[model samples]
Target: MTIAEGCILVACLLPIACAWIAKSKGFGKPRRDGGFDNHSPRQWLASLQGWQARANAAQLNSFETLPIFIAGVLVAEHQQASQPLLDALAMAFVAARAGYIGAYLADWANTRSILWTLGLACCIAMFFIG
Candidate 1:
């Protein structure tokens, strides 16, 4: 597979890392009695505080971003675009996504949004290069 294709696999792993960190926060502990009942895992996660909550949000965001990234890679590949350029853009997407996770967890809303925009731009630019 091309580097762009490989980036999709790396993209898939990003959310798992976020979730692992979030889940670790409450492992083997009862859910704090928040508004939601602990009967469901979703409810339990909703009770996560501070960085854990941000991590969960980042995890969700990663899933939201993946399909667009996958589509971009597919388009670039299908169009027989410059392999080196596509690979560089794909790598940039991965790096931006990693930065997004950090920014989100750190509660840096402006940085997170900027990273999100950057990732989207990278994905969209791949289509144009094709």
Candidate 2:
């Protein structure tokens, strides 16, 4: 894989790391029935409805965006895209995702959305530019 692809892979893995951290911190638990107990903050966040769902919304939103971005990078590379620009966008996407995760965990609503939007925009730009 190219550097840009590696960067996207890192971005993709961050939330899994966050989920692991959440699980380790008792935010979610593994049930004896060979399934996860979706009962902690993670589940609460995931099941968020109405006005209480923003953080979970943001988390899911980021999850949704990263893959498309990675796919775009892959397509671009296969089609002989501009490597420098793709690399830059990949790095920016990762940075924005990290910011989004941090801000969401901190419950900083405006900042989290801003970061999420930035990442999304980066991905969108890649789709077009790549």
Candidate 3:
């Protein structure tokens, strides 16, 4: 797999990391009854408050980007785009996403939006890279 592909795999797990940040780093305590209190994941997430809430929100947003990113990568691959270009764009997307996660957790609204744009641009750019 290309480095881009590897990063894509890593991106899949980012939400898990976000959850960890919220539940452990932010709360410093496990949830009652364990494992998000057996609530529907989204419902449980909606119940979060403070930095944990932000982290949960970011985690949701992280999942939101996946379909577009995956489609872009697959389309680029089908069109025989340059591997190095795909790699670069994919990595940029991942980097932007990481920044977005940080910005969301830190309540950096402007920064998070900027990073979202950057990541979206990377996904869009992939389509034209053929």
Candidate that would win on lDDT = 1
lDDT of 1 by residue, 8-125 (tens): 9999999999988777856665546343334686766777799989999999999999988999989989999999999999999999999999998899999999999999999999
Instruction: Please write out the lDDT profile of model 2 over residues 43-115, one tens digit for every residue.
Output: 5446444333544554466677767887878777777778898888888888988888778777788998898
- Model 1, residue 79: C-alpha shift (Å): 0.3
lDDT of 3 by residue, 19-129 (tens): 878666424335664446444656766777888899888888999999999999999999999999999999999999999999998999999999999999999999999
Model 1 regions more than 4 Å off: 30-39
List per-prediction Cα lDDT, in the order shown: 0.89, 0.70, 0.87
| Candidates 2 and 3 compared by TM-score, better number | 3
Q: Which ten residues in a row have the lowest lDDT in candidate 1?
A: 29-38
In candidate 3, which residue pairs clash? none
Off by over 4 Å in 2: 27-59
Measured against the true structure, the TM-scores of the candidates, in listed sequence, are: 0.90, 0.72, 0.87
Pitting candidate 1 against candidate 2, the one with the higher TM-score is 1
Best by TM-score: 1
Q: Total clashes, candidate 2?
A: 0
